[model samples]
Target: MAPTTLVLNAGSSSIKFALYRAGDDVSLALRYKGKLDHHAGDVHFRITDAAGRELTAPDAHGHADDPTSALLERLEPLLGDDDIVEVGHRVVHGGPDFVEPVQVDDAILRRLDALSPLAPLHQQIGLAAIRTIMRTRPALRQIACFDTAFHHDMPPVYRNFALPDLGADIRRYGFHGLSFAYIASRLDAHQRRTVVAHLGSGASVCALLDGRSINTSMSFTPLDGLMMATRSGAIDPALVLYLQRTREMCIEAVENLLYHRSGLLGVSGSSADMRTLIGERNAGARQAVAQFCARAAEHMASMMTALRGCDAIVFTGGIGENSPEIRASICDHLAWLGLRLDPVLNASGAGVITCDRSEIVARVIETNEELVIAREVRRLTQSRH
Candidate 1:
């Protein structure tokens, strides 16, 4: 039986997965890509093979007690004779310790849980899935690939905070490292100095020098970067202090406000979804969308400064790949930096959105974080042999 690996990205309300098989060229090739969205109620499971063939298309009424486990069980028959040899989980926060993917064990799991306070929104989900698999499929091998691992080697100038470190492991630990790594892999040699704007619900800008992460907008936690769909990014520290002291809000209340009640949802007073906000004609909606784009642009410009000069800027993630208006808005702000967008191309979602004469080339590339995790699992598994 051929060997396969399953890559899992368990989020708070969704579980994204991909199955990969070792290709003839010794590369891990995606077999099936899927997502299980259980945001409000039912677990809406969907999957498609590499050829765009739908394997399991559950109806909107589908619900499960444990969607992750249910999805894994359903995938068993799809594999036929192929054996799922290992699993790779996308753990968002590595904190101050982890700098690379590691084979999972009881100790590692507990250590990861300790970092929950650092990434309250995302860290626990992946760990929960890992624990489930451990209890149910104890014999199966598992590995953890961190989102912070890619930026772990950043220079002190970019990694350090301004204030003095008072015995706490507090400093920038950039998120979306896997996405940035995949993007960097796709760039050509000439696209050495580049700024990648990963604009999903949780957005951030990363500057890559020769395909290596130099500096990124997301700092300490995923919440510190670009204003996301619900996250208030890079707010004044004094404002948090004011909320705690004057507003009389507890720490938990402050966390909820910053992580869930802020950004587009807070500003627009309607929806956190960019697509929905863009469709609305109200002033609040316009302001929400405008603020998101403006902040993204400002961070991208800062990332360019970190690069000294940017040769190219690539947009990836949900909003970055789909919304041309947002991309155009960000590019417009960088006009002084020689990033000129071709209106027609930008609207059409072309690979190259910038004009031929533009000094900085702008592009839109879809990111595949699953593939990176699959490869990492394969690497670790191979090394163990």
Candidate 2:
């Protein structure tokens, strides 16, 4: 049996996982990929082969309340007789420490758990998966690939807030670093000054100068930056204060409002799924879509300011890669930067969407955060051997 590396990328509502065959030379090859989506109180699990062919029936796994346990149960059958080695997790927050991928131990897990407040929506989920694996497969090695690592080197000007030094850990520790890093790897060397918009359930804009993050929209937490599927994104600090002081809402209630009840769902008063909102004829849905696109464009422009100018704008993540209408709408707002999309290319939803004469090149690139995790796992494991 071939030695394999398992990568788990836990998000707010789902856990994406992939198995990669680890060769003796430290090369990685895709084996299988799947997602355990626990959205709207429903649990669904599915897996696909390297060629994108469905390897399991749609109704293979029944609904379950616990996503973590369900994930392991469903994944066991797929493992068959393969010899699994290490597990790599995409942890959302690494705080001021862990600028690179690190092996997870009890002490490290405790430190990571303390960062839950920083990334309330995502950190615990990833950490929970890590802890579960450690419990069930105690002998197996586990590694953590942080989402904030890519922005660890961001300039202080972009990383710090205007507030006094409350703590060293309090800074613009950007999320989606794994996604940004993958996008950077795909960009041409000439595309030094780039603004990447990772639009999805959790969205953020990043400025890449010389293929390195110089600035990003998310600050301190994933709840900052562009409005997401359910997140309120950047809001006035006074609004939060007012909600607490005058509205008499408790801290937990306010956190729930911003993290779970706001954004597209709050604005539309219907759904948070962009695909659903796009097809709806309701005025609320239309407004939600408009706001999402506008806010994304505004944030992208903000990232451009960090780069001084932008040579290219790359769109990745769920909405960015699949939603042509969204890509066009966002680019429409950026027309002032001489960015024009070829209607044909935009509709195709692949490759360069920008016109030949456009000053800023725009393209759609599918991000592989799982692959990034797997690569990190490979590097860590190889070094030990």
TM-score of each: 0.96, 0.95
lDDT of 2 by residue, 313-373 (tens): 9999999999999999999999998998999999998689988999999989999999989
Residue-level lDDT of model 1, residues 1-385, one tens digit each, is: 7788999998778888999887544488778888877755576778899998886554444445566677787677788888887889999999878887998899999999999988988998889899888988988889999999999888889988998875437888899999999999999899989999999989998999999999999888889978998999999999999999999999999999999999899999999999999999999999999999899988998888788898999999999999998999989989998888999999999999999889999999999999889988887777766
Best by lDDT: 2
Model 2 steric clash pairs:
none
* lDDT of each candidate versus the true structure: 0.89, 0.90
User: Cα lDDT of model 1 overall?
Assistant: 0.89
Supply every candidate's count of residue pairs whose N, Cα or C atoms clash at under 3 angstroms. Answer: 1, 0
Highest TM-score among the candidates is held by which one? 1
